[model samples]
Target: MPIGLAPTVRSKFEHHKIDEAALDGAPMFDLPFNPGVQIRGYSAINQPNCQIIIEDFMPGTEFDWTFVHDEMQYCISGEMEVEVSLPPLYMETTKAHITPGTVFSYPVGARKHVKVIGDAPFRHLCFCPPSPDYPFPTLEQLKGS
Candidate 1:
């Protein structure tokens, strides 16, 4: 048989939908190292290529996250104080107050410390590629080719 490639086509019948209102009161779990900050996500929307997570941070709550994949977070409500830092040796850091309309991104394996900074709960949407490994990627995998 002749070697060949076929054009990719998305099936019209293949689709996904999430009703925001339906997500109200949905069971949200704590993220590691950052317990008390509640979060919910639709895994059907999280394919092999990407993930989407929605979070609700209590006032004065904070957490540290080290991304295993490239990620972008957009504040959807209230505001938050964020301290971003690169791993040791690289050592670049920044602090900012992010409110609604504020957005940011970080490369694979960047660390971030975030604190909700207002009376109201802070809400945000996070978008990122799925990690190469479950939970986290190996050091060698993080280095890339």
Candidate 2:
């Protein structure tokens, strides 16, 4: 039998109302590295191919992230130190001093780390490829500490 590939829109229903007031009241999760850090996100609006996350990192806090899938990050505010690892063949790592308006992409399974160095909070928008492992565990998963 031939399978249909038509696109369909998913409704949030009453359980998830789309209101400015409700959205303003949405809960945010704090980053484990810094209690003052927080982030909020909603499911992709019109596409099933990506998800958006907004992250706020407090000054002096560092976050190490390992991707389960390809991802892109765009800095929105403040400054940070970004360290990215190249492929095994290269065996070289690159570091960038990024500030608001910087954008970068990481290959699937790439490992990256960031440190908030500016006095202001660092904020960024992250987009991840859609996958069964959409919400993967933190880097602590393998650190064993």
Evaluate model 1: give its TM-score.
0.69
Record all residue pairs in model 2 with backbone atoms less than 3 Å apart, i.e. clashing.
none
Leading candidate by lDDT: 1
lDDT string, candidate 2, 60-125, tens digits: 778776667788888877898989876665367889998889998888766778788968767666
Model 2, runs deviating above 4 Å: 1-47, 131-145
Provide the TM-score for each candidate, comma-separated. 0.69, 0.62
Top of the candidates by TM-score: 1
The lDDT for every candidate, in the order shown, is 0.64, 0.61
Clashing pairs in 1: none
